[model samples]
Target: MLPALAAMVFTALLPNLDQWRRHELPVLPAAADGSVTFAGARVTLVELSPAQLTTYGDQPFELPHGVMAWRAVLRLESADPTLNDYCEIALEDAAGRVYETGADEISRARTDFATCKADASPAPGASPTASASPTASASPGAAPSPTSGPDAASGSRVYETVAYFATPVGTEAVAVRLHFPSDAYHDYRLTPQG
Candidate 1:
């Protein structure tokens, strides 16, 4: 009875031990370009566009008072081939405030920026046009494409995505944080010029 009780207690405490171990891991710092590798995946922040007013599909978009929308263009590359849908991406402001990307915000960005499409292929010498509908190319019965990262056929694939954040006015010294499932995260600072 004593041995059985001990085993049960050990099992109950195992998860906590693993959590403690994960907490001890250091957070990796991303480069100025917002490029970092976590869990064998490479993530790059291609652009950060902060706008007060924008047009999406000929429709105007305006932020609420004391708020501004920031469009983040990111490129992700992974050699593991398997899609990691568990990543949590957020913007951390100088005041330690975090903002997440929502579905509505993503749709707005997608409409304004054609490159935000999951399978956007701009024709040669043809400019991108804004449309309310999602880009259609998937065949019936085909698996839905990965939303966060690019689709790759080989062991490695590179894809770009756009995330929108509504932050308060006067917010500066911002950084993008990419949190992985392993509890390890990376911070990439957004420069004023870039």
Candidate 2:
């Protein structure tokens, strides 16, 4: 009886091999200024910096005591529009702390977009340019509505995604992580910038 009970307990405590093979192992790392081709689409981390802007839109306010605004602009394009469905985007600092977009008052302020996606119809400056999160009416996790026209397929759709993070003044953002850990494409290959 004792041997049978130990076997049962050991089986229950065993690691989930199926999930590890599917989710935790696959990840693709990218450079701050380069593009990576995934199975679904082409993704580029255009520029990343601790932005030095006096304002986001036509508003102004103060940050907490010691914090700064960091920005990362990404470029995405694909043959299938469903590539726009990357559900998770976040920044990882050197110490491995993650700061998700829209986590702070400044990040949630009215800017260009709430999530990363391609605009089937490009409209520059169409979004409300407000600060202090007043006019952030852009739908979170939604792509702009595509225009109804047959000839619109002549060109590939390009999505320029801008994401922001508010962190402690001296924190250095190490990597821009995309998608969630539980996702199938979690496999990462870091390409160091020369």
Candidate 3:
């Protein structure tokens, strides 16, 4: 009976051992205009920007002293035809300070970060001559455009969002961290261009 119990315990621990081995892998790194594949989804960090203020619709939002708003533009593509929901985005400075993506009013507003849509083709039966409307400029000290995320269409899409950080006024040398939801084993880091 003692041998049988030991065998069963070892069998149960096998999966955990596999998980531990997976965690031993090194963290992945990327940069602006670089891409990485995680859990079968292809993710690319297109652009990163530091801003003083942002606009939500017509409302202007500003950060307090020693704080700034950082934006990241991501392009995701997957053959599975579903959005990649198992991911977290954050920003980290050289001093190891981490800042999470904000959900405040200004962050919630869709401001335009640089986004390149995968499918530029118009809908079937739609006129090719149709054009987008002109947008009015935001007031001084506000972001110039509205923010938007990926459309609900299947396949590939572009995602743009902002993360706010409370760092010293002249803080540079920051990098974006993309955490996988599946396991804490690995994270992707993307350093922005100066």
Candidate 4:
């Protein structure tokens, strides 16, 4: 009877062991101390000091600058919701100004992560046509247009429309703040705002 009872307990705990392994698994690359990358930077989690400061190396805290993109996992340090959980944060520039980007300015591209598996290719189809219509120009140094009417759609356009593109110009700094729907999981990519 004792051996039968032990088997029942092991069977009940087998499913839970699988779930627990999935959550606390180390999936991504861990950053080492004093390591740097152009894409982003990472800091190791350490114990809080007596003055309520998290320190690493010679500095009291690690502050990353000029980061184009980054991924960070912020753990709950204390009971203070405002300061303890660093998940939902606001971005402010060096001049005490709030950094903001309007949603309307964002591109309308969709990701196929849900539908497509790892070893799948996108469905092929005919590309869309970009109609290049003729327009009149009145600038002094501008070249005069040869055509005066709307140009017909040719075989294909020189370039295709994209969600985002890079330019020579860029902002001095940018700030990303996570807000709304508290403690939600979201996957997003950041493009250079022009």
Clashing pairs in 1: none
lDDT per residue as tens, model 1, 113-194: 3221233333233334322122222211011233333333355545555556777777762666565655544333332234
**How far out, in Å, is residue 157 in model 2?**
3.0
lDDT of each: 0.51, 0.53, 0.50, 0.23
Indicate the TM-score of model 3. 0.53
Looking at candidate 2, the ten consecutive residues that score lowest on lDDT are 128-137
Q: Which prediction has more favorable lDDT, 2 or 3?
A: 2
Residue ranges of candidate 1 with Cα displaced over 4 Å: 1-27, 31-34, 52-57, 80-82, 103-155, 182-194
Q: For model 4, what is the alpha-carbon lDDT of residue 36?
A: 13
Give the lowest summed-lDDT range of ten residues in model 3. 137-146
Q: Which residue runs of candidate 3 sit more than 4 Å off their true CA positions? A: 1-26, 31-33, 55-57, 81-83, 103-166
Model 4 C-alpha lDDT versus the unseen true structure? 0.23
lDDT (tens digit, per residue) of candidate 4 on 122-189: 11231222222111112111111122223212221111011111111232323222222232433111
For candidate 3, write residues 41-138 as lDDT tens digits: 56665556675454665566666655556666555555441334456666667786555554343454444322112223222343433321112212
Clashes of 1: 0
Compute the lDDT of residue 53 as modeled in candidate 2.
Answer: 37
Local error of candidate 2 at residue 48 (angstroms): 0.5
Instruction: Choose 1 or 2, whichever is better by TM-score.
Output: 2
**TM-scores of the candidates in the order shown:** 0.52, 0.58, 0.53, 0.18
What digit string (tens of lDDT, one per residue) describes model 2 on residues 1-194? 99999998878766445333434544566645455655455566656787653455555545667888777765555655444555456667788666767755565454344444443432434542211121222443233333323422344444446677788889988766676333565743322233
